[model samples]
Target: MENANVLIVFVSAILLFCIAFSRLITKAGIPVLVFFIFAGMIMGSEGAGGIYFDNASAASSIGNFALCYIIFAGGMATSWKSAREVLLPGALLSTAGVMITAILVGVAAHFLLGLTLMQGLLLGSVVSCTDAASVFSILRSNNMNLKAPLAPLLELESSSNDPAAYMLTITIISLMKSDGGGFFGYALMFVMQLAVGAGLGFAFGFAGALLINRIRLNSDGLYPVVAATIASFVFAAVQLMRGNGLLGVYIAAMVMGNVKLVHKTSLVRFFDGFSWLMQILVFVTLGLLVFPSQLRAVWLPALVMSAALMFLIRPAAVFITLSGFKYPLKAKLFVSWVGLRGASSIVFATYALTEGIQNADTIFNMVFFISLTSVIIQGSMLTPVASMLGQLDKEDKTLVSRSFTDYEEDIQGTLYELRVVRGSKAVGMAVSDMKFPESVRIMLIKRGESTIAPTGKTLIKEGDTLMVTTGKTEALLALKERLALV
Candidate 1:
């Protein structure tokens, strides 16, 4: 009980400090996640707080769980519409690009770190892919409105790449422990693990979405809880089966997000807030797991590897993989800089520790140090990079100038997002009696930060944004019916 209380107070103080000084930190071009982790280090085992936490197992478990939550949230956050074009390229990049990155960096690490080839590969495997929590947090906070392919590409890559990295790391760790093994056996296991993980993730994601849609509770507060709980389950079940829990969680979120689920908007809001909470929890806990005293042993190697990742390995991967993609040099450079490692690298470092590999502590400390440097040095400069590339704030002008080139030429009826006018009408009418033409359907309504799919019995209230899709002939009639101004 005493420990729990101290934990709460310590976390609360750090969170308060973060909130109070977020703006100043951003201006300094330092990502706040780095500071959150640093705060944990200061108040943790090595710092003045004297917490004495060194449980790699516990840290790994929480970090993995937090990652599941983060990935699933990313899945739910994906727009099936925007994802259409970028799907193939992104998936290819995630799986194949990860393979190339690990191999390339592993070779580089072998010579640079003077370790066994397997150890170098293991290090590469752990940090090869981008970490989602860091990328998502920075992108959203900075409000970097990327073009279609750019946004979805990054989103898809980070969300899906981890399972591959995990599989590679474990395989190499096993090889290191067992003094290497038969290629065929390892290949079989690898293929089975990936197939099972992807398959389960898809099934659970779809099923969970359907289940969420069917469960209509009497109380609104219970809704978010139910959705969040189910998302966690989606992750746990798949992972328990040795499948890809991250993939499963994300797939589940995508289903719930797009399909007409009960309180879709509420679910989005709830998960988003929960994701932020998880981010705080993740960084803090992982931060506490590090001991400053032990890091000095590996600081030289840490600096060497960090330098290689920044100047050579990362740029090489970007240039090689994205050779055919139409991204300008500036965008490519920004992409290279923004591969900020955060909790996931730290978590993978913990995974390495649990595997009992030689130099495990060195890997953990090196990754922890590198993650800090990446977020602090590269992440906070995202806005400036975007501004340099001229990609920042392009959306404001695009919104004004966008045309419905894909819509009907003639207004038989129009799909419009309606903001209910005060004193005009639609105050308390049952939707069925509103006399909106049969051609028109009030597809969805955004009311006071909540999105609702209205049925015939649903009430039409003022100050609501009704997304009504209908025919051209009934357009005026629908407006008249809404306003009762006929």
Candidate 2:
């Protein structure tokens, strides 16, 4: 118990410091993830704190759990409307693009680094997918508001591609351990994972949406708790059934996100913060698992592989996969540039080590170095690169965008603050009776200290503060007149 207390205190201190340090790093055009990784390195065994950790399995376990929340949050935040436009191209990027990148990298690794074809392919598969945590964190934290379609495309690809990457990683590992079944077996396995995963995800997501809307929790805080727990259960169940749990959780969350649930805003807010906490924990844990000294042996190879991935392989994959699509040249280029290797790559690298592969340590160190360089170089320059491609949205002066609401770009409306006055048409009337103009809605009503979501049946009291959104200035003026706004 005494040792446990000390352990808790030490962890708590690290969390507090790292969370605060994130703010400091953001101003320097650096990715906060890079800082978190370095922080863990400083506190690691080889560094000042000297805490020894070489557990690949434990790190992988924590990473899987962290991934569930991060992917779920990304899914929940995705607006179906925006995703609809880029669905085909995005799906192509996530699936075929990952495969292409992995194959190219695998071939390069096999020839250049003297690794076995299987081992090289395994390395490729692990690092193929763009990381949701890295993309979400860097883009949202830095306010890199990429223009429409591009943002959703990238988001969808990042959140959805992990399952493909995971499939390839596990499949290659299986092949390495046996007298391999041919391409037919591998193809069948991929189909099975995706099909079963999607089916289960849809079923659970529908059930979750129904439960969230119907179940009246004792406290509002419990809403997010219940939703998240159910989502985790979906992941566990799907994995137990030999399906891709990561993919299942993401699709499930996407389903839940598109539906209206009780405490929707608060639940979204809670998950947003919760996901950030998990990312920090996962990255730091991964950092602790690495020994900087081991990195020295693989640095040169790692640098060469990283260069191939960032320049040759990634670009070729993106351009080829998106060839027949309607996206502009600049969008394709931007997509290729933003392919930042992150937590998933590092986490997947541990699979090789856990399997006791001969080259596991070398693979792990190379992956770690590659992820670090990717985030430090590509992640830091996302905004500038997007700007060069003319794909970035102008900074919005009105809404103070939080990560949760960063993707709320579709609601193109002018927000108006209005106060209800005595004897106005709106006062002492139900919100439904107010007959708000078309494209105008009362999003929130603040009556003194309490805030209401402004249901149709809710009465509008005098002196209440109303936050209304309207599509046109005329509609706002009409609302002002009816409400007798001061």
Candidate 3:
């Protein structure tokens, strides 16, 4: 009981500090994720906080758990219509691009860092995929609006590309444990992992959407809880079935997000906040897992590797994989610059340490250093880079803008006024008789400039302006029908 209380207080304080300081960090043109990570390092065992956390296995577990929420929330927020525009490009980036980046980086590591081919490949794989949490948080928090389909392309690639990186890391680890396999064998494994992961992801995603929309729980609050539990189950079941759990959960959330569920507004809001919490937890826990003293030995190699990844390798992958597409040179360059390695890379590095691979400590430290470098360099410069490449959107100055802004959390439905004219069935009807959609609320009635707080018994006469607080589609459709419009 005592320990639990202490844990609660410690975690609460950390969360509060991070949340409170985020505003200040964002104002300074820095990504708040950097602050969260730095806060963890400062509070770590070697730092002032003296909180010791060196369990690789435990950190990995927490990371995977956090990823479930992070990925799902990302999917839930994705606009499918926009995703369709960049589907082909996003697919290539997430798959072929990952392979190219991994292989090239692997070669560089082998030649420059003096590691074996397989070990170098393993190191490459650890940091191959851009971490979605860091990317999304930075882009959104900064209110960045990229031109055309670039935003969705980046989001879709980041959210879906982790499986490729994970597969490569694990495959290389398997190769290291045994004699390396033939080309055909390795290729087959890659195809199977992707095929299985994607197949199960879509299947589970569709099923979750159907289930959420059909099932009606007694309480609205329970809907978010139910959705969250189902998402976690999707991940676990996929893993058990030898598929990619992260991919499955993300796809599932995307599916659920598109469908009209019972309490969708609440669900999105819940997951949005929940995802941020998980990000803080994952990054901080990763920070605690590392000892700052060890980073000194690998900083040089880390710097070279980070530069190779940010410049040569990532750009090559983006350009080569996207050559067939019609995107402008600027758009492609912007995509290359957005390749920020983050929590997932660090999390995967722990796999090396836990598996007892050769130079696991060195691999972990290098990955940690490189990920930080990516965040500090690429993350900090995303807006300016996009601006320099002429890819930043000029119309919207807001930190973030969603296509479906009405459905966004913290944004209330618009207060719209609808007038009931002649030739309307609602010409002499009571507000209660109109039977508005459950989501629509009639807030006031304006008859001859006499503003009235409408009650169910209030009559809605012709020329009356009904002030409503509801979604546009629901309110407009309901008003059209109620007013007997042709």
lDDT of each: 0.73, 0.83, 0.81
Which tens-of-lDDT digit does each residue in 1-486 have in candidate 1? 998998789778877998688767756656666778887888896786778789999989888878877776777767676666777767766777777777877887789888778778888888887877667656655545565446666766777677787778777777777755676777787787787777887777677777766777789899888877887787788778977676667767776666666666557766777877787788888888899998888888878887788777777777677888787787677667767666777788788788788888888898888878777767777778778876555633221011100111122456677677777577787778777764565667777866664555668777877787776645656576658542
lDDT of 3: 0.81
**Distance (Å) between predicted and true CA of 437, model 2?**
23
Write down the lDDT that model 1 would get. 0.73
Candidate with the greatest lDDT versus the true structure: 2
lDDT of 3 by residue, 225-281 (tens): 888888889889988877777777877787777666556777887888998889888
- Regions more than 4 Å wrong, model 1: 1-7, 390-486
Off by over 4 Å in 2: 1-10, 395-486
TM-score: the better of candidates 1 and 2: 2
RMSD of 2: 8.1
How many backbone collisions does model 3 have? 2
Better of 2 and 3 by TM-score: 2
Candidate 2 has an lDDT of 0.83
| Residue pairs whose backbone atoms clash in candidate 2 | none
Sliding window of 10 residues with minimal summed lDDT for model 2: 396-405
RMSD of 1: 8.2
- Candidates in order, TM-scores: namely 0.79, 0.83, 0.82
